[model samples]
Target chain A: MAAIQGEVSWFCCGTAWGPCGTAGGGACGTCKSGNYQHAWPNTSDACYAITHPDTCGLSMSRRGCGFRHYTTNLCNGARVGTTIADCGPQTDLFCGERTCCGSACGSNRIIDLTPAAFSAIGSLSVGLRPCSVDTV
Target chain B: MPQTLDRRRLLATAALGGVVGATGLGSLAPDAAFAAEAAAIEPGAPDPNFVEGRISKISGHLLLVLGSDTVLHSIRITDGTSIWKLHPTTFDQVAIGDGLYARGVRLPDGTLAADSVWVNIVNLHAHIAAVGRNLLHLDHKGQRIVAHVVQGRSAAVYNGTPAVSDLSLLRVGRHVQVLGAWHPDTNEIDIATVYAAA
Candidate 1:
C-alpha cells in the first residue's frame, strides 16, 4: 500500500514506570513498554468507532493483531518498524490539529507506539510528530 | 482483498517453512518486508479504545485535553489511572500543553475514564547528518535536529534485526528513523532507538 501521512505519538503498557502502571497490556493483551510494537487506529470495527478516521477524511485499513507497520518521521526521514500490539490514537478527537517540523506538517493522530517502539524513531517528550505509515 | 492477501501470505509462509526446515536455521525468514505491508488494516479505521491529545485544562481528577484534531476530551483519572511523563508518575506530574495518549473506557458523558496515560511521546524518521561524542546530528526534511545519546537507554537496529546497545554501526549520511523524547520548544531530542540499514 502507499504511505499514509498523519501524526504519530506514543503510549505505554506492560510493566513500566509511573503512570504507565495503569496501562495494562493494551487491547491486544500483548503490549508492553519494551516491545517493538504500536497501536493502529484500524484494527477492528469496534476500534473504528472510537478512532473515526472517517470524521477526519482519512481512510485507514483494518489490519489485525501482529500486523506490521513501518512509521517514518517525515521531518527527519527516520523510520521504525513495529508490530501491532494494541488499538489506538483515536483520529477524530484531534482531527484538525497539526504538528510540523521545518516545512513538513501533518495533521491527525493515526498511530501510537510503545515506549520501546516510540523511542526508536522519535522523542517521547515532544509528544507528537508528523509521520507517514507504510507496510514495509 | 484481505482474503487474497491471506492466501498469498499462506503460500509465502509455507515456502519459508520449507526453506527453514531444509536449512535447520530454526526460523522462517520470508519476505518479511513485504509481509509487513500486507498486514495492514483497511484505511480510515482505528483502534477504538485509545485517545491522543494535549492537556488544555485540569479540574480535580478530570484532565481536559485538546486532541491533535482540535477535539476536546475530558479524561478522568482514578486511583487506577497510570500516568507516564518520561517515567512513571502521578496525576500531579501532568500539566497543560502536555500531549497525552489515554487508553480506557469511554463513559456516557464523553469522558474517558483512563487506565493509562502517556504524556509527551514522539516517534519520527530522520537522516543522520553527523555523529559526535554522545550526539547525533540529524536532518528531518529541511530542519536540523540534535539528538543526544543516553547511555544504556539508546539502541540501534540494523536491517530489521533486534535492537542492540552498540550504536557504533551508525554512519554519516545514512537515513535513520528515531524514537525518543522531545524536549519541548527545541530542536533537541533524546535518542531511544535508531534504525539503519546495516
Candidate 2:
C-alpha cells in the first residue's frame, strides 16, 4: 500500500478509570491503551462517512480490523508498527491543517494511536506529531 | 546504589506481589497494572492508572485534584516519582491551580501512586499567523495564542531532522505543532519545541 502522510495523535482505551472510562472498546471492539493499535479514518463505509478525509483533498483507502501499518514520527526518526483497531480523528473538523518537517509535510488529521503505540515512537505529552503511515 | 536497588525491588513487588506498603513508593496495588496488561481489554475505555486535572489542594505528598469532568482524585507522590513543570522540577514547585496529567498505579484505597506528573504542559497544533523576535503568533483552533521562545530552551525540528536551537525555518501562514508549558488561565505558552517544514 502507498504511504499516507498526515498528523497523528494518541488516545487511551482500556478498562480504565477517570474520564477515559467511557471510551469503551472503540469501533473495532479490541483496542487497548497498552497495545500497539491505531485508528484509521477509512476502516469502513460508516467510518469513512463520519471522518470524510476526502473533504481535505485526500483519498484514503479502506482497510479493516487488524490490518498492520507502520507509522514514522516526522519530528524524529522514531517509528512503530500498529494494527488497525478503531475508527476516528474526525478529519473534516480540521480541514487544511498541515504540519511538516523539512520537506516532508502532511495535511489534516489522519490517524490516532493507542498510548502504548504512540509513546513508543513519540512522547505522549507532546500530543500531535506529523507522521507517515505505510504498509510494508 | 542501595537506594536504586530498593526502588527497583519495590517496583517489582508492585508488579508481581499486588501490594506494597506506603514507604518510599506510596501505596500502589497490582490490579490496575494487571488490568492494563490483560488481553481482553476494551479500547476507548478510561485508564484506571492515568488522571488529568487541576490541583485543588496539596497536603504534603498527597495532592487533591479536581478533574475536568468534576470528578475528585487523590494522587500520592513519592521519591521515585518524576515531576515536570515547564522543565523537570521537584515536588515543591507543584502549586495549587496548576493543571496536571499523572500516570501511575491506582491503589486499592483509590489514591493514585504517581510514577510521573506533568504540570501545565500543552501540545498545540496551530498556524504561524506571524512571527516576531523571540515570539510567534499562533492561530490554534481559531483562537489566537502567543508562544514565546526561550533563548536557551526553545528548539526546532525540521523534516525529520535532529532538533536545533535555530528557529528561522518557521514560516508565517504555515501550520506547526508546538510542545510547551502553558501559562494557566491565559492564552500564552512557552515554546519548548516547534516542529515545522523548512
> Which is the leading candidate under DockQ?
2
- List, for all models, the DockQ compared with the true complex: 0.04, 0.12
lDDT of 1 at B152: 77
Of the candidates shown, which would achieve the greatest lDDT relative to the real structure?
2
Model 1: number of clashes? 58
Q: B119 in model 1: Cα distance from truth in Å?
A: 1.8
What are the TM values for chain B, all candidates? Answer: 0.66, 0.81
Cα lDDT of all candidates, in order? 0.66, 0.71
lDDT by residue for model 2 over A96-131, one digit each (tens)? Answer: 666665665767788988766665455555556788
Runs of candidate 2 exceeding 4 Å displacement: A1-8, A11-60, A63-110, A114-122, A125-136, B1-40
* TM-score for chain A in each prediction: 0.96, 0.95
lDDT of 1 by residue, A1-136 (tens): 7998888877667553222334677888887655668899889999999778999899899998889888887766657678888887766756676667767878777898775455445445445678899997
Error of 2 at A88 (Å): 7.2
Cand. 1 TM to true fold:
0.46
